[model samples]
Every structure is written in structure tokens, then in C-alpha cells.
Target: MSAAAVAEQDGRTGPLERPAGRTCRLCGSNQLRRFLDLGVVPRCELFLTPEAVAAPDVSYPLQVWVCERCLLVQLPPLFTPEETFTDYPYFSSYSTSRVEQARTLVEDAVRRLGLGLDSFVVEVGSNDGYLLQHLVRRWIRCLGIEPSVNVGETAREKGAPTFTEFLTAETGALVRAIHGPADLVIANYVYGDVPDVTDFTRGLRSLVADDGWASIEVQHLLTLVERTEFDTIYHEHFQYFTLLTGQRALATGGLSVVDVELVDIRGGAIRIWARPTECAMEPSVRVTEVLAAEEAAGLHVARGHDGFAEAVSRVRDDLVSFLIEARRAGKKVVGYGASGNGNTLLNYCGVRPDLLAYTVDRNPYKHGRYTPGTRIPVHAPERIAADRPDYVLVLPWNLRAELLDQLSYVREWGGKLVFPIPELEVVSPAPADRPLEHPVF
Candidate 1:
């Protein structure tokens, strides 16, 4: 974005600038191409206090880059982990489907790995005991390594043993030394937050026992491209991964991919299983199959994503046009979730309160605060029913199944829900209010 536009939005006076170009985070290759640019956006998770909202927010260039050599797609790491995670407000326990997903993972791991009271488990970015709490109930010795001090404390309060620190090589080894190497190491959605994939994967390797398995879950780059999920491209996520690039990232730390599982959550994701290179099993057929699919989709090369930027812009334009038409038709549209991806979509399309009005969220921490960049007011979910708006825009579109059921009450007053990404669609709430499926981002 130009400095003039930023100045008008955030009340800044001076000229704004951001650095460009960097080596690939995985291979350190200067041979990289930018595939998508979301323009200048603030850190999405950085919610503003009432006072802070009155001040201008610092923003950065939101662009996606791909390495020619390694085929790893990334964002320039302009924001540090400290800037992104210190007082992180996203608690994983807020979504019931997500908690059930965690429980299923624990059950599967316990059965497959023969976990018992003596087995030790570790989770990086374990927010509010969403996963480890189930292990604690099973009498499994587990520890949570969390970066956010606020949510880490909540994990401890829930009887989940949590250590507040970002997992680096030293910190991972330190945790291993103090609590012993883990039988199972689980990382869900944290890989995107680490700017240095080499250090983070090494940390994952150091934390695992010789014969143990580590499962890292991240949104698949192929799915991102196919679905046009540009909203997921934010400052907090340093990179996007396919099985090929993902394996390269693991090998940096002497870990080898053994198998892969694709789950229908967060647009679509991969549950990657790896072990130390020496003891790692032969690659599973699933791995071969997924790699084949990615290759067929032209995702194994840097230029395969050539038209992603245009697709992203098309979605942005369509949504903006729809919202503008709704406004002219005398319709009211309020957002349903004050989510990070939602903020990306909002700011990229230049949707201010005049376009979105106030939004609602399930997490209480955001109730009185405002979304970063867009500065949209957040309220409790109950506000939707009380206000009876004509439309409730679903920001977290990945939670479509659950949200459809949750917002079914909107149908009481003939109100509808709007989904903005992939394509613009406005529809009545789910008719039956079905139960939530056990899938989560």
C-alpha cells in the first residue's frame, strides 16, 4: 500500500517504508519469486485495547514468496516471534470441535504408540491445554511448550503442565534434559509461526526420543492454492508447505518424513509424521500418493503458483462488490468471527466499520477490543441474536460446518449468513443445526 493510503487509514503522517527480498527460510536460496501480495496489513492477532485503537498501527508488506530450489512458499519474516506471540489471545479451547479433534489425536497416538503412564508427550504451541488436557486425563506424563504467557497460564490452570517458552534447539534440549525425551511430540499449526524452519525442526527432533514419532500439522499449500485461501496469508505465518517442501524442512534437523495424513480442517491440512533420520521408517504409500498429487497440481515448482495473485485479487474484488451492493440495498451486515484470517481479508479489501459494522467473536478476550488493521469492534456472539442483523458474515470460513449450526438461530428472523472467501455466497443458516464434525484448524 502507498504511504498516502496508510496515512489516511491509521492517522500516520510520515512516509512509511518496508524492506523487500530475502533468501528462502528453508534453503537460503536467493532464487525466489513472489506469488501473492496482500499489500500492507498489520499483525492480525495483535488486538488493540480501547486506547491503542486510537493510535496508528504499524503495518508491513504481506506477500508470499516461493524458493526455486526447495519449492517452499513463504512470507518475508518481517515480524519477529516476539512481535507475533507474546500476549497471543487465540485460545484453542474456545472451539468445541477443536477440543474433540485434540481428544481424537490423543486416542490415536495412545493406541498407535502404546502410550501409558510412563510415556511422556510434548506439544509445541499448546494453547490452553486443548490437546494435553486429554493426556492428563489418561494419566500420561505430558508437558506443553507455549510461547504466549497469557494462554500458557490458562493451560497450567487446567491441570496441563505447561512450560512458557518458544521451542528453540537449546530450549527443546533443555526441556528434554529436565523432563526426559518425549515419546510423542505434537505440533499443531505452530510451524507457520516460526520464521526459521531449520531451528524449529531441529527443536522438534531434539525433543523426541530415538524411537518416538513427531506429528506436525500445517495447512497444505496445494489446498491453499486450489481453494484460493488468500486470507490465510498473514504476517504471523512465515511460510506455507506442501509434502515436498515440508520434508525438506524436516530433513534440515535430521528428521525424515515417514507418513502423511490429510484432514479436512482449516481449508485442508496435513498431519505429517516424522522421526529422527536414523530410525525413520520407509516413506508410506500415502506420502508417495500425496507427492504425486502435488506434482500433478504443479505445486512442486516455484512458478506453479504463478496466477495465485490474480486469483486472490479476484476474490477480494468480488467480496468488496457484494458488501457494497448489500449496503446500497439497505441491508445490514455484521461479521461473525474476529479472526486473524478475517482481518487479512478485511484490511486487504479496505472494509472499515462502514462496510462491516461491528463483528462478534466467541472468545471473551476480544469482546471489548478491536481487530488489528481494520479496527472493527468485537462483541460477544449473543450480540448477533440481540441485534438481528440482516446478514452475519462468517469470517472464519474454515469452521463452516460448526458455524452453520451455531448460527442457525439467525433463520428465526429470516436473517442470512455471508461467506466471503473462495467465492461470495449468502445463504440461510443450516436447516437442521447438525452436530459439529470432529475437525479443526
Candidate 2:
């Protein structure tokens, strides 16, 4: 289920009190060990308008812990879905790469499963109908179970049938009873924000037909640690999954993992294809291949993340010094994307408006707003062209390919793009002399 759907199911917001001790959300284990301590950080997605800057806001310990029992890297559930998704700012349609990815998934699934007009498909966390819109084009019957009323309405306006609700054990049963079992169930990047893993998996179980498949994509923990992608650890993301641990979580609700694929999206992610236990076949070679890779990386144990805390510190120090030196060099460095990743990176490094000035985003909802904790103002992409800053610190660095063309104009003023994650690298973008077929921003 989407975070909005879960938040809508129970109107009660999560308690703000921090628990003295917490068992791993993936397993009922008391042997969790802390490896990364980012200190108290505000919600990454909670962008504040200029007027809301002075409002009292709550922050939580942005820490990561690995479970000794199951090795699920996770943050304590410090937030309710309501706190994050009710008016969620992340619209999947904003990224062309994301929409294309969704289209590819729908195309492949339709061809593989032979989905037709009689087939019913359900996409949990279907923000703005980015995926279901493709299914609608193919005339396939589908429903988008979105949590955010604001986002889901956009889906409806696009002719994608979207129900603004969260997924739960009861929610799934109700949907199945009313709308019938789904031929395929898809949840893209929704697991990270869900507070209740077992119940939510059960909801997925109830929604799919006995022979139907459920496809879930989650952040690959190995990629996160190896690439130093610590910015993904936010209050809303409750757990990070390894193949072994993800298999365990799925089994909790009678879903068996049959196949898996590693994809380069959202930094890095894994697509797990599962089915009801009774109809599940022998695990695919792909599943074992991924598990072996995780084993080779020693991700099956907590020790695999041993040096990551130091690596995170190094990233922060490197980025902070780079910005300070750039400022000392009398260079202007603004940000490219006003995204959650940028917020986590900025707040962790104690960056303020003085160092960053402001960042620009394609989303108008964030324009005229301040980043949640850092208070860095966000404007439209055109701001860069007007100001002609010397450098652009790419915040949503994962989408560099998609954004580079749109930002190529920055090079007109000898502006370079800076990437801070995996390691900071300053790269001159596309040729300033080259003309764009059309302006994107």
C-alpha cells in the first residue's frame, strides 16, 4: 500500500515520543546494533513554505541500525504515513525516466502474463497514474490504490481510475471482495515508508489471485552501503531490504519470492516477483544469484556495514569542504533538484542558505518554499539561467541523465554540475554551443 493509503486508514498520526528500545521491524529481534548516527534531522519531504519557516517543527534521530537476527538495515518508525504522504510532494510523473520505467514494467508484464481486458491490475502507491496510465492506454482494466488525495486526484483527472486509500489487511480483503482479485499487484518504492511490514504484506497477499504475481521494488541495501547513498535513510523509510531479509518479510504474509532482478533506479533497487505460497514455484536462479551476491558482499550479516559510518562522515566532510572552498573561490553554487535526497544531504552537512543560496526544482509546488530543515529556498529551473551560477550541485543525482539535457544551458556561463554522492565529481555538461531541440524547463 502507498503511504497515503496507510495514513488514511487510521486518522491517528504516529506518536512523537522516541521509544527506549525497538525490535527490528522485519524481525522480532532485540539484538539490533546502531552503525550510523545522523543525529536529529527533520522530515526530508516536509518542504516548508516561506511563511511556515517560523512554525514549530518536530525532528527525529536520523539513525540507521542493522539487525543481528535478520540483518534488515532500518530506521526506527519515527513518523506516521499521515505526517509524510497526506500532501506528498513527490509526483512520479515529474521524472520522464520514471514514467518510461513504469511503461516498460507494464509492457513487459502484459506480454509475459498475457494480460487482457479481463485482467484486473492494482498498483499500490500509484502516484499520479504514472504506471496505470500506460495500462489504460492499452485498454487493460486497472485500479490505482493511491494514498494521497491530492496526488490521486491528478491520477483521476488523467482517466486512470484511482482510489484514494491505503492498503492494509482489511483494506485488501475489502477490495478483493468488492472488486475481485487482481491478476497483478505492483508496489514501486512504497515498502520503504510503510511502518507495519507484516500487515502490509498481508494486504498484498489478499489482493492478488492465487495464481497471480506481486511485483515489489525496494532499495537494495548493498547498493546503498557500497555507493554511500545514506541520504535515503529518512524518518519515513522504516526498513532497507537485502534479498534474504526481503524473502523473510514476504513469507510473513504467505507470499513466496520466485524471482528477483537488480535495477539501477532510486540509486539502486531490486524487483522481487512473488506469488501466493500455494502456487509459488521453485525459486528462480535469479533469486539465488542475487542472494549469492548479497552473501558475497557479506550483507547477510550486520558486519557488512561496518565501515559505512566512517564513509558517511567522509562524504559529509568532503562535501562540506568542497562547498566552503568553492565559496572561498568566489564561486556561486546552487542546487539542481529540491528533493528529499538534497534535504537529507544538506541538513546532515549543516549547510544553510549562505553556502547553497537556493536550489531549483521542476515542481512548482516547491517553488517559493524553503527546504524543511536547511531553509534553502527552492525556485524554478529557469532561475539558474537568469542568475547564471558558476556551479549546480545536483541534488537528485540519480536522475543526472534525465536532467543533464535540461540543465545543459548552464554551461553557457561556464557553469559545471557537481555530484556529491558516491564521491563528489564536477563535470561540465553538454556543449553550450549546441542547441536543444526544444526547451524542457
TM-score: model 1 vs. ground truth: 0.93
**174-256 per-residue lDDT for model 1 (tens digits):** 99999999999999999988998899888998999999999999999989989999898888899889999989999999999
Q: TM-scores of the models, in the given order?
A: 0.93, 0.92
lDDT of 2 by residue, 1-441 (tens): 865466357552222122357888877787776768888888898889778999966788888777778877778877688777888898999999999999999998999899998999999999999999999999999999999989999999999999888889999999999899999999999977788999999999999999999999999998998999988877878888888988999999999999998988989999999999999999999998999988999788665656677889999998888888878888888998988888889999999988999999999999999998898999998899999998788999888778787788877877788888888777778754332221112
TM-score computed on alpha carbons, candidate 2:
0.92
Candidate 1, which segments miss by more than 4 Å at Cα?
1-21, 432-441
* Total backbone collisions for each predicted model: 0, 4
Q: For model 1, what is the alpha-carbon lDDT of residue 26?
A: 86
* Model 2: residue 397 alpha-carbon error in angstroms: 0.5
Candidate topping lDDT: 1
